[model samples]
Target: MFTTTAGKPLRYNHWRKSYFDSAVSAAGLADVTPHDLRAPHGTWVADRYGVMTAAHRLGTRTRA
Candidate 1:
């Protein structure tokens, strides 16, 4: 959840280009996108909690 200095939600494109990219570049990470972080987060959640919890956290539906 990122917000602007004005306390408004940051637009995805603007945040990606202006903030995310610059931070990633400064950290020396190459070819990474915001969506790329989701997998590792999901994996960590699933491992620590469970698949259902991870799915819930990720807003994904589980099959019955």
Candidate 2:
């Protein structure tokens, strides 16, 4: 069990590195990090869904 900043027991940070590394290896990619996923996910959702949705999910304002 892991504890958050608020002291709630949760499954956290256990497999984060392993999972990220596996994805990078499987995709034959380089220097990929969790932050890297944010850009593509935001871009895809903005493209397929809408700019507002993507910006909301990414917690950012859309720009022209």
Candidate 3:
């Protein structure tokens, strides 16, 4: 569901490594990967619902 201005699906690895890394680095989070962006979200969802539901929200399959 995510895309670039050219209407192509944003390449996950490239977007994460290039764009997201640079932005977070500029914001002083040099140690964070793009995937870390989901930590707070997953935590909130997990607290409100459960780990299984949080995983589902992140499109993951978990046995919790």
Looking at model 3, residue 46 earns an lDDT score of 96
lDDT of 3 by residue, 1-64 (tens): 8898889988888788768888887888668865677989999999999988889999987664
Candidate 1 — which residues are off by over 4 angstroms? none
RMSD of 3: 3.1
Q: For each candidate, what TM-score against the reference?
A: 0.76, 0.64, 0.57
- Give the clashing residue pairs of candidate 3, or none: none
lDDT of 3 at 51: 88
**Model 1 per-residue lDDT tens digits across residues 1-64:** 7799999998999989998999999999999999999999999999999999999999998886
lDDT of 3: 0.85
Stronger candidate by lDDT (1 vs 2):
1
Score candidate 3 by TM-score against the native: 0.57
| Model 3 error, position 7 (Å) | 1.4
* Model 3 error, position 60 (Å): 5.3
Each candidate's clash count: 0, 0, 0
User: In what order do the candidates fall by lDDT, top score first?
Assistant: 1, 3, 2
CA error at residue 49 for candidate 3, angstroms: 3.7
Scored against the true structure, residue 29 in model 1 reaches a CA lDDT of 94
